[model samples]
Target: MANLLIIDTATESCSVALKYDDQVYTRSEIAPRMHGELVLPMVEAVLAEAGIKLTQLDAIAYGQGPGAFTGIRICISVVQGLAFGADLPVIGISSLQALAQGLYQDKKQARVLAAIDARMGEVYWGQYEVDANGLMKLLDQERVCSPEFVTISDPDTSIVYSAVGTGWSTYAKVLSETLNVPTVIHDKPLYPFAEYMIPMAEYLYISGESYAAELAVPVYLRDDVAKKAKDL
Candidate 1:
């Protein structure tokens, strides 16, 4: 059993989870602009509940995102510090893939369309197809684009796609009409969660995908736009 600590602050949500001895403990809250303060506490809480020090963890995992610019920075920076201080390797999970994994975990759906509202009339979106082992695999490249411009690559018309994340909630009808495929949407898994990152991290760690603390990075798709909006 691997001891894993994971955190996600890529959206409006701030969450932390510890995977210990085949079990998981988590703390999460939807707190926009408060991730810097809230994330560390959540991390401490999960670690305490798991009864392990930071150094005891196998590796640190984080939601490196195509989500909020500030929130993604906070997550990667905090995780970088903790991993560096503890000499732990790090694994970065995609926010879009995590959103798809969240649905796969909760809905048992194999085909998913994950999208985050990218603002400025666009979204950061990707298509995910789960394998028999219940792991989400990205079907195509993830990109930031308008709802009309977003397209699912080689989508299974025979299967119903599960539409997930904040983008769907914000543009339900338009997305449905735009995708030109049948979709089942649930607005609850609108943000990436640390809990979902654990499974992906498990696979990556076993595949020797962890990296040094300094290598941990964020994946903000609309950094320029997000920064300009922040300045305003």
Candidate 2:
């Protein structure tokens, strides 16, 4: 088992989590424009509470987005710097998957869709299906586009599932009027949480899905979006 550190400032939430074996220690705050001010302190708080040091961490995991351009960049840079300083492996988890994982408890089914409001009338969307072992696998590459045009292109739609994300909560009327799929909207679980990323981080760590500091990158779905993930 690895001692892991995870961070996310990719939305209205600022969160940090440290995981060892099966235990997790987390610190989070809901501050829209306060990512810069809150992230480092949050990380220190979580590490202190967990009795872990950055040097002792086996790896650092971060939410590489399909979320806010600025928020995504801040998280990547923080993780990159911390990992580099500690000489630890680094993993980038999908922000959308973290949001979907937050909805596991309310599961009407195993399949899930994660979306975040990408502003400019568009959303960052992705699909996933949980396996028998309870691990989630990505069903498709993530996308960013207007909510009016997003759809389930996959033909197999047997199970009823809940939709989790701020994008859906924000564009409820537009989505309802557009997509015909039956969904139980989860407004409370909309924001992506660092705690939700732990299990996936552990899996990736075990599988050696990690990289060096210079390899750290954010998955920005919008090409024309000026700001890179580091700007947050």
User: Evaluated with TM-score, which candidate comes out highest?
Assistant: 1
lDDT of 2 by residue, 45-160 (tens): 88788776789878999988777777888898898888878999898988888887777745534677778988888888877778765666778678888988877756344656
lDDT of 1 at 84: 85
Candidate 1 — which residues are off by over 4 angstroms? 223-232
Candidate 1 lDDT over 68-174, as tens digits, reads 88888888889999998999999999999999999989888788899899888988999999987789999879899889888988756677889899999988888
Leading candidate by lDDT:
1
| Local error of candidate 1 at residue 187 (angstroms) | 2.0
lDDT values, one for every candidate:
0.88, 0.81
Clash number for each model? 0, 3
Clashing pairs in 1: none
